[model samples]
Target: MSVWEKIKEKTEAGERLSSEEGVYLFREADLHQLGQLADGVRERKVGKRASYVLNRYLNYSNICVLSCQFCAFARRKREPGTFELSVSEVVDGAKQAVALGATEIHIVGGLHPSLPYEFYLEMLRGLAGLEPRPMLKVFTAIEIRHLAERVAKKPMVEVLGDLQEAGLDSLTGGGAEIFDAGVRERICRGKESAEEWLEVHRTWHGMGGRSTATMLYGHVETAEQRVDHLQKLRGLQDETGGFTGFIPFAFEPSQTRLAELGKIRRASALEELRVIAASRLILDNFDHVTAYWISTGLPLAQVALSYGADDLHGTIGEEKIFHMAGAKTPVGQTRGNLERAIREAGREPVQRNTFYEAIRS
Candidate 1:
């Protein structure tokens, strides 16, 4: 048989595809054929019940120490738009979200050069104390490393332990752009290395914690590099089994240096669906693959369900990062809106908590 036929046979048999096969599928597989294979896998794994979370996003601060070339959200400490919420302010915002029926409060921020380690613990403590506590999914692997190596000056294990004690339910899947060292250096020089990012998650999993994974694609990365990134994530998941889901973020080029340099543009909708479908196939070990509507508009995100996505991330309240990058989606979607979208896509909508557990169907 030909290479494509061989891949089709393996995929049909539910066997793991090699990195070469993943790259080939990503580059050469017919879009509809790939979608069929991926949708078949998704159906076997999670069925037609798609999910959404009633979650709120909180960016505690924007003053970052590193100037990643592709990031439009980070600002200098004295920059005009720089802001950091006090612990009380963050708790108050989360309290309002909880009152409005949010089941998860997703928080992430830059690697601030000055916030003391106590600030994070205090913020977590206050949010944890809220009545009907929500799952506090906070911090990326990069932020965790920053807290350990910079602010806390403690070991990563110790820092994660402290954060968990203070009530961190899970880790956010940001900060993992493209994991290829060459491409990563071109876009996000001085950011944590791919190994460092993986090590952070590995350590967290060793502590019996769970988190999600992400890949920021459509930037300065090749198809081979993208497959390599997925292979690495799959290897880690094989070892730890701690990843709850995978989110593939399309690089939003507007307002970013890459855009200014004329080196990048937004990924096309076809590319976005291809990435989602490829992720579903390659990351077979992962249970969920999220079509984050904040970056991909709701319309395309709705189309992504038939393309292989099983989860429409969540109802994020006022997201700044993607908005800063010129995302035009609404700041948030209501539960009714999410259900309507799912139902329109010919799938049953399931209300899910952070762990993909159905809160209601």
Candidate 2:
């Protein structure tokens, strides 16, 4: 049977595709064909409403111990301009985010080599104590793992439990650069290994904590590797069912060791669309697929809605990681801009909280 025939059969049966089938969908399917299949899956799950949020990203520090080659954001502990935000300073930033109508505070920072585990707990407490507190979605699995071993000196499960008690709402999928160890070794050595990243999320999911899964594509990863990454996430979701969304980000090559090794190039618009559409089709157990506007740009991100994306992550008042790594998009977007984009895509826009609960617009 032809590949299209197999994919259609799987779609008809409402069965999940294998990794090889997903790879074929990424590489061989035409635009409309892939979009139609993905949209069918999306409709079966999320319906017609496109979800969004108003949020702010706080990069609390640039001081990091692991210098990943693909990273353009982290700085050495003794680097001239390296900095860390005190607990009071992060709270002040959260105040700014809340005053600007943000309902969620997204926080991710470099792994501090010396900070104790109590520091993270203190940050979460500070955010939780604010009036009209926004949901605190903070920390990557790598940072969590680091804290577990280096600071808390406890197991991953216990450490995560402690943080949950301290008011961490969710985990962001940042440390998952790519799930292939060969690629990981070349791009982001000395950080959490692929297995470790998965294990951390597994631990979180087992504890009933929800988080998003991400794939960092378009750098040195193969189409097959991308499928493998998705498949691994799918397998985990099947077992634990704690993933809230899947976000596929193309690697930014500027101002990093990856660029120094060669000329930096961003993923083409076509590649972004293909990944979005394919993600919708493959991640059968996941409820939402997000087009992160900061990384994909407004134009391509708007187009992504038709391809299979049901969520436009947020109107981020400020974003640092993408900008520091050569993103040319605006840091802030208005509600008007978000509504227009969804309308232009022929979809209804609904504002939502971090948990996908609708907020009255």
Candidate whose TM-score is highest: 1
lDDT of 2 by residue, 44-115 (tens): 887888888888889889899898988878898888768799999999999888888888899999988888
For model 1, which pairs clash? Answer: none
- Consecutive 10-residue window with the lowest summed lDDT within model 2: 255-264
Model 1 backbone overlap count: 0
Worst lDDT 10-window in candidate 1: 257-266
Question: How accurate locally is residue 250 in candidate 2, as Cα lDDT from 0 to 100?
Answer: 85
lDDT (C-alpha, whole model) for all candidates: 0.91, 0.87
Model 2 collision count: 0
In candidate 1 the C-alpha lDDT for residue 5 amounts to 84
* Residue 14 CA displacement from its true place in model 2, Å: 1.1
Strongest candidate by lDDT:
1
Evaluate model 1: give its lDDT: 0.91
The deviation in Å at residue 246 for candidate 2 is: 0.5
Q: Count the backbone clashes (under 3 Å) in each candidate.
A: 0, 0
